[model samples]
Target: MADEDNPDSGGTVIGYERELADITGAIDRYGTGAPSHIAIVAEPMAGRTTLVAEIRRIYGDRVNYLPLEFVIMDSTVLDCSTYEGDIILIDNCQFLSTRKIGGFDVLDMFLRTQITSKKLFITTWNIHSWQYLCSVMNLDAYFPTIVTLNRMDMPVLKQVILSRYKPGEIRFLDEGVAERSMFFSVIHSTMRLPFTSAEISVPWIKLNFTLMLRKLPRKKRVQISLEDVILEKINRIAYGNPGVALMLWDESLKDNAISLSAITETPFSISLDTNESFILSVILSMESLHAKDLAAIAGSEMDIDRVIYRLVQQRLVRDNAGYYSIEPFALGPVTDYLRKTRRLW
Candidate 1:
């Protein structure tokens, strides 16, 4: 809110003040006597890039930045020997490895080089990839300070969105409608075990009070702002990922006005076979990949074309040229599915 008018303030970087401070503090400590490396980890489109940009803004010319995009850059560029800065910033470190080849070799070399060099390395990683690498290589132990972004609260999310627009630039519709409340009944039953008696709780569907309330006349209910409802839904679908939230906001907007009914979430009932699911997870982790890369990751046995066709038909994936990626709105649902299936760590 303080920087609402400041053109340079890249919105509120909400929910990350402490993280920014810790990063800067580490840099300062390293400058004086202490030496440390930092890792900023978050899910895809969770503002890792924005956070890194803020870091560059804060440090200015004092820090050297190396942003990595594995899809476009060669793997050999990861060599840290050529970089001559005391403070190094690397983005998308997840690209160090791919599904076909275990890229721990490059990661090992990078880590070895950084550990020996007197430099403060600040890096960002995809949460899933970070977890995988940590499990495989104990990667967390290498970075003395690691800051993870958590799911943001409603108010912070609101501020983050509001910061992107000038006051009154966009209309927030408020339809005077009270949201329906859900209620459930728990049934307690007594059961006899083989050797002992026990009481257990069972959940049962109760009357749909919310539905009944919705049937009432509009005049009798307390009106909730449509803008609040829309934002709440966007935040929910985004799972507190700022980038995802912004994308949802842009997609939902119609002629500069947003309505509660206009905001919709991708259905989570996607059906994928084992191989399809694995390929989807790979795409989500990598953000995007070519068919060849997907095949390499899926292994020789997988019919990559059939899987891609199925996913595309379901609207779960979109193909650009030969590259494949999860549809924008489908990101949340895909992530939820992966988390449920333990594909995402």
Candidate 2:
């Protein structure tokens, strides 16, 4: 059976079986003459584009693909109305609006078009942006079929990362650390007092395969391989985001060989002011943004250059030419800080 006929029949699902099913099921509903617009929502680098690509691959020319790379204008949206396809596919729908006063104008326009148009619209969104929009504009009511992606489990993430490779293509090497039980790690953090700043050193314990394997019976523990241990570490650090796990997988793969110690964490303490935190929040939602547009959303009070410099120096955000984004490995930590400080919606 075809993917449109059955979502599970699709290739390289990236563990999005449920989301793909929701989307294709909506498409099936459209075949019955009742159009159900779809929204694919996920965190940045969490496979939003991958999902859109899978849809296009399955549906072929029946889908019209329009991916927004930056903040869009009213004219761009005017052009969007002209695409005549059974399924209109869009990626990075977060770019349809900005976070400023007049920023949501284009999004509002697009939503209106979606409400009145007869064509089935299948759109992708950054999860943070969707949440913010939901809070402010009640965005959920617009799309009856909402496909939201979340973190995968260790087994699912392993399948996703290995799907790209042929069987036994990559070798997992044992480094003899499997027998060791406990390890000590130290990280530096800062606390800002009313008058002075101070650094604090903290020691923490990390659970490798030792703690987990110990819970199992002796026979089961003996059955686990270095491969299982390596993948588990990757999933733990990635926090179940397949994209980040794959990135870590690629980084750990050296000359087609991987070891337990090779997959490590990217450690950096994140401390930001109100303005800096807000900018980071914007980058998290938009995924990537140019300095000019970031300035527009950040407004006139902020010195965009300095903020960018600080974020870059701290390794929280990366500046590619001018398109700034949260560092792939830093996504989890950055998000936690933003949410804890209430900078993100």
What pairs collide in candidate 2?
Answer: none
RMSD for each of the candidates: 8.5, 9.2
Q: Candidate 1 on 43-107: residue-level lDDT in tens?
A: 77776777787777777776688877554334467666666666889888887777556645677
Model 1: how far is 192 from its true place, Å?
41
Kindly report which residue stretches of model 2 are placed more than 4 angstroms away from their true locations once superposed. Answer: 1-10, 31-34, 76-81, 176-221
Where is model 1 poorest over a 10-residue stretch in terms of lDDT?
182-191
- Model 1's alpha-carbon lDDT is 0.72
Each candidate structure's TM-score, on Cα atoms with residue i matched to residue i, is: 0.80, 0.84
Name the lDDT value of residue 260 in candidate 1.
65
How many pairs of residues collide in each model?
0, 0
User: Best candidate per lDDT, number?
Assistant: 2
Candidate 1 TM-score, C-alpha based: 0.80
